[model samples]
Target: MKVEDITSSEQAIALEDQHGAHNYHPLPAVLKKGKGVFVWDVENKKYYDFLSAYSAVNQGHCHPRIVNAMTKQAETITLTSRAFHNNVLGVFEKYATEYFDFDKLLPMNTGAEAVETAIKICRKWAYEKKGIAETEAQIVVFENNFHGRTTTIISFSNDEGARKNFGPYTPGFIKIAYDDTHSLEEILKENKNIAGVLIEPIQGEAGVYTPADSFIPKVKELCNAHNVLFMADEIQTGIARTGALLAVCGKCDCQGHCERQATYSRPDLLILGKALSGGAYPVSAVLADNEVMNVIQPGQHGSTFGGNPVAAAVAMEALEVVRDEKLAQNARKLGDLFRSELNRYIVDSSVVNLVRGRGLLNAIVINDAEDSSTAWDICVALKENGLLAKPTHGNIIRFAPPLVINEEQILDCVKIITDTLKQFEK
Candidate 1:
């Protein structure tokens, strides 16, 4: 069959299996289009997009404002790499740095690259400013963290699947328990060579494990006491997904930047991605104050498409959509409703153990064993029942619909989700 004429989901899956690498084992539903919080499969069957492209579509899919900005810039000029300056890049950098209350911003094309950039900045700051010996500065990370799959990142990862064959792993990392401040303090006190403490306010990939309310505050305090940089990787949890501009904003629901909020736990290095361009384009960034960021000199780090005009325009518009549409406020209100409704059903549920997350980023732990296929089967059923979700770490399913979803849509999704889970109830 001609590729253009292929209309069946089976045909699409077969084509991918034949031509594509088996790096990702996605759900069987082959989606053709997306708008707002919904996606249409190849057969024209519509389903709620619970995953939101792993929280990349926080402003919703194919948002007109972001799309228009991208297309407009593409038509004007797409790329003028760092070998020379571009007009839009400076504008985006200024807007983004001001938006996040950072002194500077480093642009990159993907989450993994941003994480790598943060790592490089942390280590360089250690040597140049912190007075740590070269190659001796170590960054502390939490267990069950998902920073990305780069070699340096996987070196410190506990996931055997991602790390098993990808060694000899890079060194200079210390792993500690999540939400444990005593361990962090102990490590920092014991090791004067520590450069930074990297954390995810809510571990999205590790089954949406939300840390204690006091956990992050204490982390920032400890980092300050030890003079270590506090780095937050908010790739999946930022951009209104956590009901705030950034996950480190905690419970603050203000429409403005979180710098002045009492709940804000400002990070020295803030790594963001996924929804930065509203899923219209690939855009990720690392933000920092001058003290922590100025360590990197020219000819040190950059990407070919890092600050392309298209990325600049799309990201600026995407962030504007988040602010103007009040998505963070919406995510906060709906998240509470979503959890309340889910809890009403989970109280007596034998199939789901619990629900946990911040804002729209949430997960339900399956009662079955981690190695069991029950969660995957339930996800397939969810697709059939008119909603789409995917399982993580075998038995935990993440549900993060677009922030554009309204009360009625979220309630409808909750019903669909609870009803689907009821089918597998013991």
Candidate 2:
């Protein structure tokens, strides 16, 4: 029962199954270590990491630069709280705001916190600036959206599993179908009390659902016309996961230049997390321009560990890695190879109905019932074949590897996936 006795993957898996709170049903293999695109199980079996910690490790696992920065900061100072200033915080804020082209950055520790912060900022702006009456500001959200797991977040979620027994929910949220601009526009036009429209440029959780190319620009226009704040929850899609710096960049095919102008769909508020620290540390932030971010005077919304020194140091290095390494460019190249290779098999295989996504953030739709266990079965088979992936919905499995992945590695992964699918067919 001791750690030494657990020399095999099964033993480690057994220990977790017995002691841990069954929050997640992970694949049977027990990951002992990871570097770049590969992970080693407890038994020393190697497998390609395809999830990238839900797109949080865009710069790869345990990136030396980010880890070194974190270690250096840890040796000096890790946490000072927001009561006093930390050297790294100001630098991180300045660097991040400039990197994201935002006027201000409110640092937090988790993705959900950033989302909550964005929500609070929008509400404050609605009341103070937009003249919305107290307790009457509504935010328009999309169906099948996965913002976070906070009570307030789940309150607006349409997923039964996420919302069941989680209510009576938080109010003032209107839900509409996703990818339907007309539905959003109709709601916005009729609901004069709407304060903001919070959306994911590409829905990550319900599956990597990329909206139409014009969706973001049109939504921004609608929000501007109605004086409603346009907020983007780029927690999973940001940080170059979608081949762009942000999914809203409207340059799915381009690497450096965006097809749409920067001002075309500039969000009033932006929520970021996951890869902000390159999976080295948990660092998330809410970004806003002066007018929107200035609503919160002080003591309104804060977290004790929100802007810790370790997070600040780690985030700065992580973002630097993204820019210096050109991870976005790498993701764009590898992602095209991944989807193009998969499409060849998908055209002939009944097991896979479709493969859709941008950059490294992609998913495969299994040709099975929504409640079927086909995707899970495929994932288990994939694990046996030296690749690691997980099913998001019942019939959808997302395959988002680290952005640091190379062409040879991607082609190898494609072979693993195609070979595995062929076995399933037999």
Candidate 3:
């Protein structure tokens, strides 16, 4: 059958199972189109996109501004490679650096690549600037962190499924407990070879685990005291997903001038992705001031399509959408409402234990064991009831809708979610 003629969800699933890699186990709903806060399945069933493509569609699906920028740039010059100077690249770099209050930005194609780039920059800065011996720099990471699945990244991962048979792992990383400031302090005091401490402001894949408010500031203080680079991996929590422009912004949702906010704990190295292109295309970036960024000379690191014109245009427009729509403010206001509404329901709930998260990135913990299928079953039921969410770990379902969702829409979603949970109540 012709691809366009194949309209059934079963047909699409069978085709993927036959021709595609068996890597992802997606929801049964085969989506064919999406708008601001809604998606349509192949069968024309509509559902609220609670996942937002793992927080990549913060500007909403097929955002007109981002799409227009991408299409316009594609029409002119999609790629010139870093060999020749592209007009849009430098403009985007300047805009983004100023927007995020950084001095420089190193663009890449994916969140994983940006993370790897940050690692390279950190190690190089340690060797050249911090005076660490070559190959002796050790970076600290948190347990249950979800960076990406690159060989070097997965090497430090604790996920057995991702690590099994994927040895030997890369060295020079020290894993520590998440949200433990004392351990970080002890390690920083003991280890002089430490180059950087990489952390997610919120551990998204580990079930929207929001750390203590004091945790991030203490980490920044420790990194400052030890002369180590503090790298924040905001791939999933950035771009206003966490109520603020960046998760590290704490409670402030100011458009810019993050340094002026007392709640903001600035990271030396900032890694951003997912929503960088508003889910329109691949674009990720590593941002830092000149002192740390200058360590990498030209030809040391780059990608063929890293800073392409299309990516530049799309990313610029995407970030603009965030500011123009006041998505950070929207996320903050709605997130509080979301959690409050869920908490009210949880008081009498037997299936859901609690709801926790910042902004639109929230999760509900099922009262079942982590190995149980209860969360998955509820997610399937949510899909059937006109909402789309996914289970992480096993008993946790993350609910991060587009930042564009309104209060009325969110209330409707809450009803759908609560009604579905009632079906599985113990």
- TM-scores of all predicted structures: 0.99, 0.97, 0.99
Model 3 stretches with alpha carbons more than 4 Å out: 253-257
* Model 3: per-residue Cα lDDT over 271-303, one tens digit each: 999999999999999999999999999899999
Residue 7 of model 2 has an lDDT of 88
lDDT of each: 0.93, 0.89, 0.94
Q: Candidate 1: list runs displaced more than 4 Å.
A: 1-3
The better candidate by lDDT, 1 or 2, is 1
Q: What is the lDDT of residue 81 in candidate 2?
A: 88
Q: Is candidate 1 or candidate 3 better by lDDT?
A: 3
Cα lDDT of model 2 by residue, 246-325, tens digit? 88887655553342556337789989999999999899999999998998887999999999999999999998898888
Q: Any residue pairs clashing in model 3, and if so which?
A: none
Question: How many clashing residue pairs appear in each of the predictions shown?
Answer: 0, 0, 0
